[model samples]
Target: MKHQSTGESLSTYSPLLLFICFLISLPISAQDEPKISVGGALRFNYNLSSWKEGQKNRGGDFGYDMFRVNFNARFKGVYLNAEYRLYSDAFGGGVLKQGWMGYKFSDIDEIQIGLTQVPFGIQQYNSHNWFFNLTYYVGLEDDHDMGLKYIHAGEKFEYHLAFFKGAEELNFGSETESSTSRYSYDVVGRNKEINQFNGKFVYKFGDKAANRLGVSAQYGSLYNLDTKENGDHYGLAAHYEFSQDRWNVKAQALTASHNPKNAAGENRDVLKFGAYGAPYQVAADFNLYSLAVSRNIPVNLGPVSNLEFYNDFGYMQKQKSQFTDSYMNVTGVLVTAGQVYTYIDYAAGYNHSWLGGNFKDDFAAGNPDAKWEARFNINIGYYF
Candidate 1:
C-alpha cells in the first residue's frame, strides 16, 4: 500500500551537512585531554529462502547487512557519541543512526539530549537473535527518536525516562518504491508535531543481576498540519529474564493501540508503524509475545572460543479479524572468537510473520494463504 507524497524534497547536501557539523565540533583540550575512541562493525550475510508459489522469487543471495562506524569522546563528565551507517539499498543507504551529547552524573546516572533510542519496550541489545524481536518491526522495540532522556541505575532498580519530539525523517525514494524509509518510517507523518513520552522500569534480582523483570510504556500525540488531523497512540509491555550458569530464558508481552484520524480510508497517510507497513487504521490494536532460550555449549573448535545455541519464537495476534495473525521461529548457533562472530540459522514463518519482509499482499488480495516459508542464513561479522 502506497500514498501520495506531500512534503517538500530534502536538500541533496543534507548528508554532507551533518557530516561537516560532526567534524567541526571536535573537543579542544587544554590540560585534561579528552579520550577519543573509534569503533565499528562490518557484517556479511548469505541467505537462501523458500517462498510461496505465488510470491515473488527470493533465493540464494549475498550482501552486506551493515557497515557502521561509531565515534565517542569523553572528557570530565561530558561525552559525545555518534554512529554512521553505510547500508544496502534493501535497508536504506547512508544515514546517521545516533548522534547525542550527554553528561554523566555518576557511574550509573546520565542525562542525554539529541537523537537516541525510545525506551518503550525490551531493550534491543538484550535479544539473542540478530534480527531482534518482532517488536522492532512494529516500532515498540529497537526504534530510535529525537528526544531528551534521563537514566538512573541503582542497586536493585533501573529506570529510563524520555520525552521525544519525533523520529528522524530519511526518505530514500518515492513512497511507492521499496525503500528503507517505507519500512522504518516512524509513527508520525510529515508536517506533524508529535509529542512522545516513554518510560521503562526494571527490578533486578540479586547482586549478580542475573534475573530481572521490566515494565515499559509509551504515549504519543500527533498534530498533522497537512491533513489537519490528530492521532494518538499508547503502548504497554512487560518482560522477564532469568539466567543460570549455562542457560538463559527471556520473554516479553506487548500490546499497543494506534488511532489514526483517517484509519478507515482506502488511500491515506500511512500509519507508519504498528504492524509492518500497515495502512492507516487497518489494525487499530496489536498484541505481541516473544520468547528466547539460549545455552552455552562446552566444546570449542579451532579459533572459536565460545559456542552458543538459541531459539526464538514470536507471535502476533491481530485485533482486527481481517488482518491475519503471524508466527515466526528462528533457531541458530552463534560462534565467537575475539572480535569475530558468526551465525548459522534456520528461520521459518507464516503470513507476514518474519521481519525480513511483509507478506500481507495475499490477504489484501482476498486470497488467504497458509503456505510455510523458510530461510537459511549464514551471517558473519567482525568488530574493530
Candidate 2:
C-alpha cells in the first residue's frame, strides 16, 4: 500500500517539475539567442518652388526644408525605437515620430509600450521602404501618442490593438471665436481633447506562383469629444510577382469616415484608389516608371542614389452639399549620398466655388466665389 501511494505522488509531481524546467529554460534560451544591435537613418529634403493659378498653396520657397532622424536598438526579445523630425517653417519644430519599447514572444506575438506609431495600416508596418518607387497619400499620419499594443501573427492572419490620445495636440479654444475659428480649433486641437482607441486586422493568401493578396481594416474612436464622434477606415491590397522575373504588380483601395473635428476637417464620403507595376533589370541600370492619383502625394524620387526627381498631383470634384472644388500640382527633386537626402519642390494649385446655393448658405455664408493660391517648399533630412 505504501509503495503504491508513493508511486502516485511521484507521477503527480513529475508534470509540475517539467513545467518548472520549461519556465527556467525560457530566459536562458532567450539570452542565448543573440545580443542586441543599434542602428538608424537620417533623411533630409529641400524644396524650391513657384506656384501659379490652378494649384494648391504650400507656402514659402528656399527654406531649411524638413529633417528626419531615427534611432533604434534591438536585442533578443526587447527593442527601443525613436524618431525626430524638423519641418522647415511649420509648427512643432522638433517632434517625436515613434518612441517605443517592444517585446517579442517567439515569432508570433509582440507587445509594445510608449508613444509609437498607430498600427492601423500597411504603411505603418513598412514605412522604412524608401527604395520602392511607389507613392501613396492615404496613409496614417505618424502621430506619437501614449499607447500599449498587442500583435499576433500567423501564416495567414495578423492583428493589432492600440489606445492613444485622439488628437496629437489638445485644443482648448477660447470663447468669442466665430464658427470658422471654433471649427478650426476643434479640428486642429485648440479645445478639449479626447482619448482614442484603434484596432486593425489583416489576412493574406495565394502563395503559389510567387503571388499574394491581402485585406486590412482599421477603426478609431474618440471618447471625450462633445459629440463623441468616431472615425473608421479600411484598406484592401493585392500583390503579385512572376517567378524568375523582375516584374511586380500591386493595387490598393482605401476608405475612411469623415469626422469634421479631425485635421483636414472636411466631412465627406471619399474613396481613394491606387495601382502600380514595375519591371526592372530589363534595362541597363533598372529604369522605372510609376503613375498614381490621390488626395495627396507625400514623397517622390527617381532611381538615382545621388540625384533624383519626382512630382505630386491631385484633383477633387465638388460634392452635392459642398460648394467648392480643388486641384493641386507639385513636382520636386532629391539628392542623396551617404546618409543625407535633400529635396526641392515647386507647387501651384487653386480652389473654386459657386455662391448663393443652399450649401453655400449653410456653410460659407456667401463668403466668396473663388480663390487662387501658390506655394514652394524645400526640405532636408539625414539618417545614421
Candidate 3:
C-alpha cells in the first residue's frame, strides 16, 4: 500500500494563495476599514502508553506538540479564515488545517470554498478528550477536503451540502509524491479519492434548539492511478445530540464501504489511508458506532474556571468475514481557564491504530489481540 516516492513534489496552493493576495490588494476606502483578526496557539503533550514498551518501562515521555497561526479577515459580508500548523517532523510537520474564503448572505446562510471541513457525524466534535474515537482515524470525523460548501440555518432546521474535488493535495500530478503528510486522512498510494458529494440534514427541537437529530449521506468516486478504472464509495450516518442544563449526550451510527480499483494482486478489501505523516490500512467495508456523554462541573480553582468530565466509546465492525472488530474507550476531563485549556485522558482500545496495535495493519485484517491496551495522556495549549 505504498506509493512511489518522487524526488520532487509540487503544491496546489497557488490558486488559493493567489485569491488571498487579491483580497489583500483590494482598495479599501478611508471611510471603511477591513476587520482583520490574527491569533493562534502553542501546545505541549505528555503521554504514557502501555503499548510503547520503552516509554512504559521508563515512566513516560513529554515533548513539544505544536505551534499554529490563525489569520482571518472580514470586509462587509465577505471573509476569509485560515489556520496553519507546525508540528514535529515525527508528526506531520507544517500543514494548513483549513483555509476558506466565504460569503455570508445573511446571519444564517453562507457559502465557503477551499479546504473546508466536511459536515458529518457531529457539528464540532463528538469526543471531549484529546484522543478522538475510532471514527476520527477512519476519516469519518473531522475530515476536511478541497471543496465548496453551502450552509443554511433555518429556524426549525439546518443543512449542509458540499462537493469536494479531492483531498488537500500537496503534490500536483507532475510527480509521485509519496509522503503522507497531512491533517486529514485520505486514500493514498496508487489510488486517489475524487469527486466527492456530501449532504447533511438536522432537525432541532426544544429551547434554544438544544436538541438535534440528524442524518448524513455521502458518495464519491475513486480514481486508480494504476488501474485507470473508476471506483466509488458510499456512506450513511445517523446522529443525535441532547443537551440539558449542564449535561450533554452525543451518539452516532455510521456505515461506509470503499472499493478501489487497485493493481492486480493488490488487496481490494484493504486500502491505504494516510495522515499525520503516516499511513495505515482500513477495511474496505465496516459499520461504526460511537457514544459520548459529558457533564460540566463549575470549578473555582485558581486559574481554572470550569471542568468537563466525559466518556466516549467507539466500535468498528468489519464487514469482511472473520475480521475482528475494533473498539475504543476514552474517559477524560477538560479543564478550561482564561486562555488555556487542557485535556487529561485515560484511553484504551483494541485493534486501534493510535491506542495500541500495529500502526499499519490494525485496522485491516487485524489479528487476535492479547488484551486491551491503555494510555494516559495530557495535552495543554495556550490560546491568544
Most lDDT-accurate candidate: 3
* lDDT agreement with native, every candidate: 0.68, 0.39, 0.86
Q: Give the runs in model 3 whose Cα sits over 4 Å from its true position.
A: 1-31, 174-179
Clashes of 1: 0
Better candidate by TM-score, 1 or 2: 1
User: Of the candidates shown, which would achieve the greatest TM-score relative to the real structure?
Assistant: 3
RMSD after Cα superposition, model 3: 4.7
Instruction: Give model 3's TM-score versus the native structure.
Output: 0.91
Candidate 3 local lDDT, 211-237, one digit each (tens)? 999999999988787767769998999
Error of 1 at 221 (Å): 1.3
Q: After superposition, how far is residue 111 of candidate 2 from its true place, in Å?
A: 2.0
Ranking by lDDT: 3, 1, 2
137-204 per-residue lDDT for model 1 (tens digits): 56666677766788998879999988776566444333322223433335533323257888999998
